[model samples]
Target: GAGVSQSPSNKVTEKGKDVELRCDPISGHTALYWYRQSLGQGLEFLIYFQGNSAPDKSGLPSDRFSAERTGGSVSTLTIQRTQQEDSAVYLCASSFEGLNYEQYFGPGTRLTVT
Candidate 1:
């Protein structure tokens, strides 16, 4: 089965511009996650979604960041009014149903705001 996939493996945008990052998780997966990793930094959980449960957006850095998952499948992360500090690798992962499960990760969308 195909694993997770993300578009625009690299993105360069100016401050105040908006960016939409896409993610395609494995087929039949019910759990999906979005995370951000800065240079020489650890992964930061941005959101987590499973089935029809409400998404956990506690990790979203600010109001400018938002995401949505449709039909318990693909997801999109939108950054409104991007900033220089928004430069990082946006990673998407999916698991079976539990946090203990092994989460498969996508290639990631690297956004460089300048």
Candidate 2:
């Protein structure tokens, strides 16, 4: 793809449900990132995967959140036991080799936990 792409542009789930969001980065991009944005708040970094290095999961808000990248291209974020606070827009971005890290972002999946 010419740019990053994400699945299920919108998702609505009940509290305590588990949700999985998917992302496909631009071909050859070596870095992938997951973030979340709540209303009137800044983007919260969730996870990062670059090349073969260990994924930087320092940004995950809680143990209920997890993500992985396969083949250094596709990524998925899973949120377990979702809470109302989990309602937010989940974003994915990609860059090549972190050169100033000008990332290309996908249309985020808006999650509504009710």
Best by lDDT: 1
Off by over 4 Å in 1: none
What are the lDDT figures for the candidates, one per model? 0.91, 0.89
lDDT of 2 at 39: 97
Candidate 1, residue 22: the lDDT equals 92
Model 1 TM-score, 2 decimals:
0.95
- Which residue pairs collide in model 1, if any? none
lDDT of 2 at 110: 99
TM-score of structure candidate 2: 0.94
lDDT of 1 by residue, 23-104 (tens): 9899988998999999999999998888745456779999999888888888889999999999999999988997689999
Quote the lDDT for 101 in model 1. Answer: 92
RMSD of each: 1.0, 1.3
* Tens digits of lDDT, candidate 2, 2-85: 889999899999999999999999998898888899999999888788864544678899999988777777888999999999
User: In each prediction, how many residue pairs overlap at the backbone (N, C-alpha, C within less than 3 A)?
Assistant: 0, 0
